[model samples]
Target: MKRVASTLHQGALLGLLCIPVAQAATGDAGSDAGTQASPTLKAVTVTATRREESLQKVPVAVTVLDGETLERDNRNNVSSIVQEIPTLNYRPSASNKDSSLFVRGIGTISTSPGVEPSVATVVDGVVYARPGQSTLDLLDVDRIEVLRGPQGTLFGKNASAGVLNIVTRDIPEQTHGYVDYAHYGGGDENRLRFGIGGRLSDTLKGSLTTSVGRYDGNVENVTNGHEVNGYERKGVRGKLEFQPRDDLKLTLIGDYSDGENDTPSVVVKPSAAVAAGISPVVPGNSNRKISSDYKTYVDDRNQGLSLQADWSLANDFTLTSITAWRGWNNSQYQDNDNLAALPVTAVHDKGTVDYDQLSQEVRLTSPKGQFVEYVLGTYLFHGKSDETYRRLSVTNSVGNTGVADYSATNDSYAVFGESTFNFRSDLRGIFGLRYTLDQIEYDHRRVSTSAVEVNSIRPSYASSGSHTDSGISGRVGLQYDLSDNLTSYITYSRGYKGPAYNVYFNMQATDVQPLDPETSNTWEVGLKSSAWSNRLTANLALFHSKYENYQANFYDVVGTSVVTRLINAGSVTSQGVELDYALQATRQLKLSGSLAYTQARIDQFACPSGAAASCDINGKPLPFTPDWKSFVRADYDIPLDNGLDVELGTDYSWQSKVQYSLDQNPNSEEGAYGIWNASVGLADYSKGWRVALVGKNLADKAYAPVLSTGTSTTRIVPRDDRRYFGVQLHKDF
Candidate 1:
């Protein structure tokens, strides 16, 4: 309690100190602005509803961030962006191929190839089928929109929770380029990014972007006398746009990314019995250091190509086609025991997944002056993936190995339509619907062998199966314009996720089974207001969702080994309230904040048979769902006499206690924590140059991002980059 109080006090003091400086600067500059008008907040446009519209007029609960804001705040990746959004959470897996993301208490916990993410990740207009692809580096991005609700009707399948839409920068007709460099304090961490765009001919334009980044590990391996968890990545992207006529356009995009890093290190927090038998804990070991007997590593490669075409037809009709091919290959090795003792247990996983997708969409949009505006669209998608997995567990006396080859294909078709009826000048009724059909087929084969262990040997197994399902999802809403500055809406929506298969390969192949599909129904009420002459914007949303046939990952102790399997739980419920506000206090000062309260629980669930332990988990909080989250940010600009400006900014975020596993054991809980970050910079926009110094986790707080429960011990992955400072420089031409 005392610590929390102290941190809050510090944050308040910082805010107080910065506000007066901004006020004084504004007062002094008023003398020269006699004829100038006060600044107002600019209108933000988003495509969250599948059409370009003003954010303030949209009826959905959404958050939008432009490229300028992201660059100014030094948010370089998806994980960092989650901190600013109150309703989102991100956790890195043991390997880069299986990160976890949760929105509104609904997400995917399993990293198997067969399982799909609940929150759809859409780049441009194409959805990434695998979560690993969503973790790619952000480069040349124009804007990002986070929609916090079921988006099944417009986004198609696998959108039960929400949607993350990313729009990349397009090729410009004029020639332009920029370069950026950043260097971090401690252990020589650095990054570089460059981009160029120009027109090759009257009808042809192209743009190219590339980035290279490297960071030293923050964790030290005491046993091996080496650093662990370091990372290096390289990426390149190219885009070409061709315009044969005024109403027809075509775009081609290709990208390649390669990254290698040390596997995430685990710090053991054993039970009382296990702790008593081991040596005394080292002083100052904390979560930043580990003692491991074996080495850990990961290597990943990804590449993709996409072609998009759009054509305008008569009477406001449009046709669109997208074709894409993406592939991922990864190899990972980890020291599972997380100890320096002999007879250690280690694991190696190597797999490759190749995906090809083709989609076509056609929409007929009614004119704006009509009493009823409507849009009708049809979509078709087909994708196929081939995956090969090899896992090895080695000990002093025996080596256990398992190899699996799997292939899957999916075909989805949907017809969707939405319309808005203007009953009055200030009232509107919105309705939408989508009918979808999905067909999936899979084939799997696995073989296991063990040396020096007669009982561990198992026969080779092969299986093939197919399934088909269909469903209807839709949305209904009513929006009222209360005034020029305030708008309110109420909505109800339904969403769905397709069925999946268990892809884990092991000696006990008999335990695997196909999992059922999941569905969700959500109701939301929201209010959006712009006050103080459009200088302040505030939004509030209250939502409730019920899920049926919830898919979950279960861990069971089979004989002497632990196995993971997918199952369909009975039901789950989630309710939450979210608030977001932004204020332009003055021409040179800006403030923004968000707060969310979520209560997500499993209404009914029963443990499956043939497991080491069996019990009911009724009325338990879902995994990775925090009770409360809040964030606040302040930015102030100080004008200088020489056409230069100094910018000062600070932000603070807090999250309540969270459960890392479904079991809800006391050891799996993480206590509440807060983080603070600050930055100072000097910029001259006319000259296209800027320099900034940024600091993160100024209080040097220690926390764990993930916790794993083993057979007898619990391991935690600590959040890296503690109390670090960095300098960033940017140049443009």
Candidate 2:
């Protein structure tokens, strides 16, 4: 492989982030490295191992996105950042309720109240129980750490796939704040945000941040005379810090957000029956125009409260505790038929969800540079959710209408610890383990029905069940120092996810069984190097993982209705190679990029005895697991005699073709494509004022992240699916 340099900040995403020319990332080699003659990257901090450490010192494969990168990306939700990540992908739906995440081709695709996500999302040490919670717009984010591979020992939840760890900025010690505003063309987007923080006394401080934003969608809606797939959102976040004693510190954080999203999939490849009545509203299918009888909308609210305390014990060890509560509510209405006017009376489709969770974690950490440094902790969690889904039959003239209401609860307990042994100064060994117990239960009932629904609806029937499971997950690894600034390591880990129940509205007799726990074992080897006096940095890793009883969704036809049921696949495997590189090419320029090659596939379907002929899907690529993916970026800086500086940057991201259907449906495949973005900014650091003009998809490339052929050949349109321009203004006080 050819060796190249890349900055440590991969967060700029397909070019959403900026890797400064004169700056690298992680710890500073020396003050001289920052000189104009030989500029070096500065220190970047992270807590991937449950402790504050330099990014380069961490053993895990991690991607860091700094605060500045997010500001420039101007993409608010979590999905915006996944676009260009090496081996990371997301599952898109019409609403957050069906959103999911994938890593190395492993992810969950079910919305059952009893099914937990494979990829876990953590915000300041608090896990978001549902995948949708992580989709909310971020506020005052300090950084985001995307950890590839399993993180089961320390996190000790359903983090069998990977983890997206988000860290919010801390309260400022001095009285200061910032204001940001942006206006965009094409979609008529306008956004404004304000943040202020200060110290009230020697022992107390607080900060507040508020934001509001709205945009017209890129997709045209002819029936409603309003653009669909648009966004309207408002949110606020607050934080308080108190240090009554030198040994103790307490922090309280609260946040709330409300959003309205108009999302309705459009038929990219219309079926024979649905294409005859359509007329051209937009030029072509790629123009992203749709016609629906009833306006489709998804409204949601999310709020949370957390209290964290850190105490420095007299014995030199640190003790910490975090208590948190979070809640999310969502309601949605969609045009199920997805046609302007069809004989199907499927317009009365709706869904509602109310979910809440409470959790507590207490941990103790030993001081560094000891014979045995370790972190020990205990975790407890409780969650409850209620859902109601009502839909009119697509074949209303020949089908029926009904409502399904269900509720579920999940409880977990675990004890976990990790230790690093310094066998020698240059060589170390790390081992960790976690013991977890999970309990899940659900109650579902079908109450109302019209048109004398068929046997699939199961009206007037109620059922309830519970399940319990336990497992041990852990990791073992070794690190060897080859040189002063280079290290090599190999690790083996076992990860696990809890069992699940299919608790959807259409309660059938065969759907009452609980799924088995999902498990994976992985082996990875990597090299971390920052050579040539800290001007060049490169990290490389190769990993292979085997998963058993992988949870997935399977469609079964019954009486003119396609029911989506949860099941376990026999076996699967994911093996990949990843590279992150950055280099300070010159004092005025920098070059950076990341690349990955992945082969994720199904080894066996574990088909049934008789009709197993259809299960010959062995060797098929997993959904969203592209074989090749890469991102490249360049940045340049110039200084003028007027005490001002200018920054220019550009980036491009591309990936090979991948199937979006688990069943290997050809209509759900998206071919290879790439996107380009550019930005120009002028800044005056002394006065803390800046202005920038940003353009995304400059080539006007058209692509979709998700597609479905079950009902119709439909595609979900995303923001930035087309060319758009925005200008941003910022001021600091």
The global C-alpha lDDT for each of the candidates, from Candidate 1 onward, is 0.75, 0.82
Q: List the residue pairs that clash in candidate 1.
A: none
The lowest-lDDT stretch of 10 consecutive residues in candidate 1 is 450-459
Candidate 2, lDDT over the whole model: 0.82
TM-score of each: 0.90, 0.93
Error of 2 at 630 (Å): 0.9
* TM-score (C-alpha) between model 1 and the true structure: 0.90
Model 2 segments more than 4 A misplaced:
1-37, 281-285, 342-344, 394-399, 448-460, 608-614
Per-residue CA lDDT of model 2 for 200-302, tens digit only, reads 9999999999999998888888776787788899999999999999999999999999999888888788766556534554323375888777778899999
